[model samples]
Target: MTDQDTLDAPRDGTKEARLVAALTGKGQTLKQLSALLTWQPHTVRAAMTRLRKRGYVIDRVAKTEKSAARFKLRGDRA
Candidate 1:
């Protein structure tokens, strides 16, 4: 299947699923994820931690001083 098709595969309709889908593409900042999920920044961070525990390698991409840090999924154990 196409990458977009893979990413768009049926999910369980959970916020976490949406979070992973977002991260599967270009890096996203905490604020962006928060706005996308309608969650607080801390909540998004916590979710990232949970994903880590679940074997997703999320990398923090440093940005210019004027920009917030961005995060992306490096890979998944699965």
Candidate 2:
């Protein structure tokens, strides 16, 4: 999993793979994703950055203050 071929999907790597998988298919919020992934928000952000770079477009939609964030996916290619 070099930097170049890092897709947002679970794409064959063990590290951060589950997090990316949960995010891509489940549309979990940042907080929820953090909890589910057992990762901090910053870790989530870092993983998300790598995911986005690999053609995974994630939109951080602001929802209610109390509710968790609404994660949205963008782009034609995964």
Candidate 3:
């Protein structure tokens, strides 16, 4: 399914679902995620941790001098 389709699934509108959708593509920074969910950065990170525990493969890209850290959702664990 397309990225947008995933975002619009039955769980659409939930913060976690939106976070998954945002990470479905090119990935997003913590700031972006927080803004989208209207949550604090730490709260977003906690939610990501919860997703990881639930078997979602969330990859974190280290921050570089040029940009902030980025997170991408690589789907569930095999």
Candidate 4:
């Protein structure tokens, strides 16, 4: 698909898609993504791995020990 087509494609209702949507324009912590998706932290991490396998770039922002790291989609639209 064209780059724009890839960018504009609708989410297919998968957990990974939902994660991508959530991270489209903003970063969110693992806890926030888990809460938003009603998924466990490990599940969120697995979905992120799948997204990476599918060639989506994800950025992680490290925070303090007491805070969860933040994640966001990088260099692409939702």
Error of 2 at 40 (Å): 1.4
Task: Give candidate 2 misplaced runs (Cα > 4 Å).
Answer: 1-9, 13-15, 75-78
Tens-digit lDDT track of model 1 for 1-78? 123333433357899989988887677899999999999999999999887766677889898889988898875222
For each candidate, what TM-score against the reference?
0.77, 0.63, 0.77, 0.74
Clashing pairs in 4: none
- Give the per-residue Cα lDDT of candidate 4 at 55: 67
Candidate lDDT scores, in order, read 0.79, 0.65, 0.77, 0.76
Off by over 4 Å in 4: 1-11, 64-67, 76-78
Instruction: Please write out the lDDT profile of model 2 over residues 1-78, one tens digit for every residue.
Output: 233234435546555676655655446788887888778889888988877777766766677878767664543133
Candidate achieving higher TM-score, 1 or 4: 1
What residue pairs clash in candidate 2, if any at all? Answer: none
| Cα lDDT tens digits for candidate 4, 1-78 | 223236443369966568878877767998999999999999999988877766677889788878778898785543
The segments of candidate 1 whose C-alpha lies over 4 angstroms from its true place after superposition are: 1-11, 75-78
Top-scoring candidate (lDDT): 1
Backbone N/Cα/C clashes per model: 0, 0, 0, 0
